[model samples]
Target: MDVRKLAACVLVAATAGCTVVPGSNMNRMNSVWFDDTPEEYTPAETDIQYIPINATVLAHLNQQAQKQPLSNAELEAAISSYHYKIGLGDILTITVWEHPELTIPSGSFRGAEESGNEVKADGSVFYPYAGTLYVLGLTTSEVKDLVTERLSSVIKRPQVDVRVASFKSQRVYVSGAVKQPGIAPVTNVPLTLVDAIDQRGGLDEDAAWGDVRLTRNGHTRNISLRSLYEQGAWSENILLQHGDQIHVPRNDADKIFVLGEVNRPQGLPMSRTGTTLAEALASANGINESKADGRGIYVLRNTGISRDENNNPIYTATIYHLNAASAVGFMLADKFALTPRDIVYVSPAPITRWNRFLSQLLPSIVATDRIGDIQNNN
Candidate 1:
């Protein structure tokens, strides 16, 4: 359908639904007039704790933010004591002193990886003089000492060296919102969670760095990359182990919804670094100055579950009101922090966005009708 005709139809549908009351001059109901009484309305039931934004609230919130998140002490201990032990499918190069037959030389013809002793499923490898040595969960230095002791029976003052040729047994898989989702091999050098992420090409642009999940054994834990990188929380950077899974989820769930009287209403993703309420408002192009009440700005935050006086579980929510009509409003907004999934609403929005749209569109509708009539006459 033509835009002119569509607009005319819409206007007619909107304005033509008026019913006049009998024997009354001003009983006609239309867009401009409404006979709705205040008693006919039912306000929604809400348990709102409308706390005003002030220094006291700011201090309390700041104190809560200052409470540092505890790190994994057990994981930290394991990481500190961790040493690379030989596992099945791992390749090891055993070099014997003054002996060329026992050693697999990584020369121009074959690399060390190609000519290395692969650990069997039973975790034992057979060398020339060492026979079969069970080296499972044994470090390279231990294996070297074992080979030297075994060779001492045949040769006098036997020397041996053991090194990992290729690490294929143990790996940590990095998936989800990373630049490259792949596996990072466990090596002699310690591989931390951050190291594995870096190996997989770091986090993607849409990654919620604070929502990373690490699955070890059968259990999983939420690990915040922001705590490690931005807040200097070294303890949060736990070491990655074999069969571990690291997943950085997308930031879609971490977006703050901005609605109600705004110049440009939008959903802004929460930054892993930090995002203030002022920055969120700026992203939505500020408030609708004419229709919205600047002093009645509210931030609705879900504070999770809380118990009522009866001890029964009840859902808890907080409504924080900010008076932004004063000179220090912007300063207050700058200090206010917004969490993920928070909703911002500018109050007293008497006129809706649709009303603005119709006002702008009415002139064009009238012009189009005039043009159509002129064309019909010609």
Candidate 2:
């Protein structure tokens, strides 16, 4: 070699130390190495629970699914028993038997008579005999009884009927990932979870149906839309109250990201039935035949923190491994659920890893040589 070429080789060797391997450097950059003794904020592999994806793990998860807080029937009964209360801006139509003059105005000049009385902001409506009776915070039945008692003094046993002509008082808000997100007016018709959702024009294509959040009063509850529809967990369809805010979160966590030696490296959103490991692989068109290390298929999950049995704080993630070289491994993949935001990585074969290292390393090395040649030519 020429003196200049030898110097360039020496410089490359010195700058890129012999101990510095491309794989280790890339792993560090990717934060893939899990240390036993992790520094603060750096998660340790020991902190993570490593589980082999198998029938036993799948059985355990299936067992947990059986323990529901409320059944579908119970939820339906509770939500169905709800009664509507009168509120401000409600238009009430009160009918007094044998009193057409009092109920419906019949002035010939005005074609149709204005019969409905609008409940004012103060929560009371005006009538011929009742005269601005307090109706706010009262149910339709309660208002009818009150009107009956008030008119009894004027007319002897005056039969009275009260009905909501147009309900416009209370409203529930439906927002986020809905086709038409806005306030849905609560009327005489009892507004249930289903009603509010339908009023807002149902969920968008990108909606995270697995987790629908409902905020009522000061508290919030997560309702699974998937459970309600697919699993027939009708109890999830709870009654919505006034001032309630229903937000359907976007399927932002809806995707399971596939990386490494997969045929297609992309994020596949969970289907309506929920995504499984096998399904995610199928969406990505399975692993690369030549380059993939089927034995090294891993699912990385960050499960947040929790208290151990000793009451000590334990941060944990779950790294699930699957060796898909066998038929049983493929079956296990089908059973293993791929939760939202999960990272499904297919590690490259040993030969492929070397190719990857060289692929990344060669470009920089070539670029450096090109610069050196340009300077030499000048």
Candidate 3:
């Protein structure tokens, strides 16, 4: 190997050693500091916790995993109990048994079976025998009872049936990162978050399945589809109501960025399957065996300022380290869940890097500097 060229590379790198600008967001989010440093080394205002990766930590983290609000049974019950109300512009088909003459008029443009009576702006629908009956704020079953009562005055033992012919009143708007973005009408059948999305032919390729935003009556909530599929959390499939807006956002959580002495540096896409440190490293072909300090594997998690109960701004910056030299280190890495936009870094061996610098890198840099000096003198 060209020893002079190798030394020059190290000299240039050493001259510009790792720097952390104090009070910078980037510094707090991306730390290259060693784990062996004294505890007294005051971190920025952010309460940065440096945790050593171990079995206990993994178990605790797994237990603290956030669970979905609704279970499968609860979701099913909600669906079964859901009832849709009549709204203005809703078309209803009113049927009267054993009274065909009253129900369907001969020479009528639209047949009784195919025709529907629309709920007018006054919240009333005009029927042949029932006259103008109020249906807005009532269910299909309630409308049936009202029609039956009104028909009894005209005919003896009247049986009436009411069904929604065309649902056009209550609807939910679906937009952004979907195959089709538009208003989906709510019918007598139950309408759910999943059903609404499916009606539009499912989400587009760029849709952020993990961060779906739902706005209902000006109140917005975020739902993670990742938790639904992975944890089977049924609550994520919530029932969509009237005037509800659901937007499938594009995946912009960034990436699980891995850098430093790893064999392959990359910004890996975080998966719903819960990407762990070991999986990320494997994708990057693991840390450099020759130069990597197994004791210095660190994962930096950047948390923006969050307000506490007292409304005080709390900066909770967390960094996790794995001592890969230990037998259990790889096991711990396998269980450590990586959050989106996390930064994983495997540092070079401190002693080896310094030795290389002193033996070759430093010499080449000095020689190059002296050569420059000689040229200037000439």
Top-TM-score candidate index: 3
lDDT of 1 by residue, 164-213 (tens): 99998999999999999999999998899989999989999999998899
What are the per-residue Cα lDDT tens digits for candidate 2 across 211-247? 8999987899998878677666676787777999999
> Each model's C-alpha lDDT?
0.80, 0.79, 0.80
Worst 10 residues of 2 by lDDT: 24-33
Off by over 4 Å in 2: 1-46, 108-113, 306-315, 354-378
Cα TM-score per model: 0.75, 0.78, 0.79
Show where candidate 1 strays beyond 4 Å. 1-50, 69-80, 105-109, 306-313, 349-378
Worst 10 residues of 3 by lDDT: 18-27
- Report the Cα lDDT for residue 128, model 1: 80
By TM-score rank, best first, the candidates go 3, 2, 1
Model 3: runs farther than 4 Å from truth?
1-44, 66-77, 108-114, 307-312, 352-378
How many residue pairs of model 3 clash at the backbone? 1
Instruction: State each model's C-alpha RMSD to the native.
Output: 10.2, 6.4, 7.0
